[model samples]
Target: MPIIDNPIVLSDASLVLIEQKKATANFSHANWGDEDLQPVRREIREHYRNVQRLVCVYCLGSVSAHSAAGAPVEHIVPKSQHLHFMFEPENLCVICPDCNEFKSNRESLVNPVLTANRVNYPRNSALYRIVHPHFDSYDNHIAKFNRLYVECSDKGGYTIYICNLNRFFRRFGRCDELVNDVALAEQAERFFEDGIAPEQP
Candidate 1:
């Protein structure tokens, strides 16, 4: 499934607040936590949590349902770098804390050459190095085998690396209990074959 099937829709009040914030000369990402925006943040978290089926967009880990902190609202493009996109729905998603920390403020653009010239948020998957939660299908770029994530493409590899998708394995050494499931392994192997096989003309 795609990470985010639908983007959050802001209410009129929320839209007004965001616009008002942006109009201010001192507006910055730091204001993301302002008390007035808490309601907006909460709404975004709940919307994405449901749309992403409570899974971290990067590692596919289960998102915490008990608390808002469990699933943080992620800015695909670091809000600090592009404060203009802070309220962009396409730029937002909810992810597990581990993935969030690992992916913090890293460059996500496919072309570093365009970084300085960037003015608008990109909508094309080809413009991103990471698997875009909204624009790219997760299965097309990555395959999962039990606890392991296998990249189907460069974007998938970048996503896995940037997010430390194998964090569990790194923290906990490989053991019999962590072995890949036989059925899932077989499926993953087929996926690898399909991913690498040359397309018929």
Candidate 2:
């Protein structure tokens, strides 16, 4: 997937535009209203695509070099239930078609946002709090062992199962075991952070 190398989130006004144009954004290619917004959408689309290639927040796989990517700006907390975060630039992320499909509306357990009592991260489950993109590091929530970043020791097994990182790997490929997925994800994280190339992987 495209990795967001250096993300400089847009201002709140841009978030307002995103919120105002939410429903029709898909149809309009994010040009829901205001003639001036046309340029904003164009830039957002372009930047989202580039960011996906430059850096990957959690999914460590490198994007395919074959085709142009689908640059959908994903809501880290999801927009369907959390209306307030519809335009949050910090919540926005670029993901590949496969990762997007796997993540499609699938609620994250231990939502970090709701742990802080925000409406952005919904209470998807009664078990684990949602993991927030705004807070909580993936590493802290899920510690790396053999090849999997299992749930942090503090949270227990329920929280690890809650995150559903395994389902993510299954959707991509059987690259690792449940534990291994966590490890590989951590590997990908280090890869992105340390500037390791695919040549080494």
Query: What is the per-residue lDDT of model 2 for residues 106-183, given as tens digits with 9 covering 90 to 100?
Result: 555455454445745332324334334334444444444333444543442333443344554546775445435765
Q: With candidate 1 superimposed using the best TM-score fit, by how many Å does residue 177's alpha carbon deviate from the native?
A: 4.8
Model 2 misplaced stretches (Cα beyond 4 Å): 1-42, 45-53, 63-69, 108-130, 143-149, 153-164, 167-201
Per-residue alpha-carbon lDDT of candidate 1 for residues 1-201, written as tens digits (9 for 90 to 100): 466878999888889888887787888999998888888998889898889888888888888876978989999988887776889899999999989999999989877556645667788889899999999988788776666677888998999999988777788868344344665555656666766421211
lDDT of each: 0.81, 0.48
The candidate maximizing TM-score is: 1
Residue 201, candidate 1: alpha-carbon lDDT: 12
- Taking the candidates one at a time, how many backbone clashes does each contain? 0, 28
